[model samples]
Target: MNSQFNFRFSALLILLVATLVTACKKGDNVVPSPDLGAQVAGTYTYSELKTGGKTYPASDTNLKGTIKLTRQTATTVAIQLAIVHKATNETFADDAAEDVEVVESGIGNIELHYNGDTIAKIKGTKISIEGEDDAGTLFTLFATK
Candidate 1:
């Protein structure tokens, strides 16, 4: 190649590489969500557990309640729910189990899956949950600040 052609070619190659590198780099303008899933973790006072359309309030035995996000990853999440006695502050043994990889988030609503089936959708700060034992059972929980 001639000197001028070689110079032009080199410039073009540099420009192409620069363009590709910039494109691959994450954009600073793009901002991520305010961590709606993080809000899912924490303690919740037992209001009730809803089955189908009816809400069954917890008994005096089930006074204190706690929900925890054991693992929060890019594409996976693990959660746990526990009940405790208000007076004794003792956590219930049988109720403290984790839901490993319970939800994969995308777009706006996060689809929660348990035992190879969809449980509910979580969006923004509101969570829609259903008992895995029965799909018909549904409950809505608002994320507390």
Candidate 2:
């Protein structure tokens, strides 16, 4: 009779513990992540440009540029580029902002995509973009806010 009572008591205690564990809510204390688009929205000046195994600083007389990023929506960012080619004394400016989808790539990294292609990556206050011109000159731009 004593062994039967002990077994029943142990079973009751196990059931109580199981119920308490399952009743507790998860993620109640978890902090939500910030919006990637909003976090990266700002004006960034080009710090460096790389092409043909050569790097040009922002102060380089040949090339300079600035990029403006605006948060268009929760998952979208608009980008506008203003660039100057000193050799040709020409300026390239976007008449309209291009929309790009911002997606979280990792814990602290975000990627910008346009037309199903990744055009840029943002980490902290820095952004790196890769593109080619009409003449097929592949270049990478590193900018910082």
Candidate 3:
């Protein structure tokens, strides 16, 4: 009778421990990504510009610029680019604020979409953007806040 009782008690204890272990299993603690539009909404000055395999630094008198980013929504931002060409004293600028969508947000970077195409990325205080002009000249702008 004693041996039988001991066996029954051991079995019950083992069952209780197993149940507790299962009940205390780790849960899925999913954390959502940050809102990149709001996080990166600020003015940034051009650090460099690349086009047609030619690189222009910000110190280049003819191709210096700034970009303004305004948060319009949790996932959208209004961007205006203003670049000045000193030789001609011509200012190339967006006549109106263009709406850009923040399509993807990750741990260290955020991707931006313009006109249904991915054209920009923001990491830390820097933004890199690629675009083409009406003449089909491809360009990339690197800016920092």
| lDDT, candidate 2, at 9 | 100
Q: Give Cα-based local distance difference scores for all models.
A: 0.53, 0.81, 0.79
> For every candidate structure, what is the RMSD over all alpha carbons to the true structure, in angstroms?
6.8, 3.4, 3.7
**By lDDT: ranked, best first:** 2, 3, 1
Best model number under lDDT: 2
Alpha-carbon deviation at 137 in model 1, angstroms: 8.3
List the pairs of residues colliding in candidate 3: none
lDDT of 2 at 45: 85
Tens digits of per-residue lDDT for model 1, 1-145: 5999999999999999999888877686578755544644444445545555665555523354645454464444565555456678775422333353445466766665656776545565444444433344345432221
Q: Residues 1-145, candidate 2, lDDT per residue (tens digit)?
A: 9999999999999999998776774546567766777888999987888889898887874766788889988788899877778677487434335679999999878998988988789888888888776788998888899
Q: Please report how far candidate 3 places residue 44 from its true position, in Å.
A: 1.0
lDDT of 3 at 119: 68
Residue 28 of model 3: what lDDT? 36
In model 1, the runs with Cα more than 4 Å from the true position are 1-64, 84-99, 102-106, 132-145
Better by TM-score, candidate 2 or 1: 2
Ranking by TM-score: 2, 3, 1
